[model samples]
Target: MISRGSIVVMAIGGALLIISIAHHSQEWMRVASRLGPIISVILDGGLAISLISAGWWLRKQQTTLTPDE
Candidate 1:
């Protein structure tokens, strides 16, 4: 089973990823430009990696908790 904390973290990470991508659009670039490309890359990549890792961890935990039968 996935923990509530993991769910929350995934949600937050998903939201951040969406925001970062949306901000990359031409119209949204004006706002995203404030953070600049480098910072945005780091922020987005970090969030994506964290979310993926969390999900992988949760999956591993879930499998471990289940009975082989």
Candidate 2:
């Protein structure tokens, strides 16, 4: 069982991991001109997801109420 916040975090992290691994494949290999654009996309996508999820989680935590009863 996953909460919405957990799912959001997981999805963001998963996309980043998959693409980050893919984007870095060439760093350990021979450099190719075609790889630059792909890496940028991967980086951007990862950054976006990470930022959005973090923001959402922060907001949720801030808004949650504690039981006083």
Candidate 3:
């Protein structure tokens, strides 16, 4: 079973991914331009994906290590 913390982390990551995609619009271009488009994309998307992966890994580890009752 997945832990609550893991679910929360994955949820936040999903939200971040959505925000990152939305940030690509013209209005947000100014912020991206300041950070550099490539770097901004990498930071936003990479971090989100990493968080999601971490949460999944945590859940897997928890399930594997726990004793089945």
The model with the greatest lDDT is 3
Model 3 residue pairs with clashes: none
TM-scores of all predicted structures: 0.52, 0.41, 0.74
| Global lDDT of each candidate | 0.69, 0.64, 0.80
Q: Lowest summed-lDDT stretch of 10 residues in model 1?
A: 25-34
Per-residue lDDT for 11-33 in model 2, tens only? 67767766666666645365556
Report each candidate's C-alpha RMSD, comma-separated, in the order given: 4.5, 5.1, 3.1
Q: Could you give the candidate ranking by TM-score, starting with the highest?
A: 3, 1, 2
Name the lDDT of candidate 1.
Answer: 0.69
Better of 1 and 3 by TM-score: 3
lDDT of 1 at 36: 70
Using lDDT as the yardstick, the better of models 1 and 3 is: 3
lDDT of candidate 1 at residue 46, scale 0 to 100: 83
- On residues 1-69, what C-alpha lDDT tens digit does candidate 1 reach at each position? 556776676777778777766765533455645557657667776877789678668757866895669
Model 1: how far is 15 from its true place, Å? 0.5
lDDT of 3 at 15: 93
What tens digits encode model 3's per-residue C-alpha lDDT throughout 19-49?
A: 8867854435666354565666678889999
**lDDT score for residue 57 of model 2:** 74
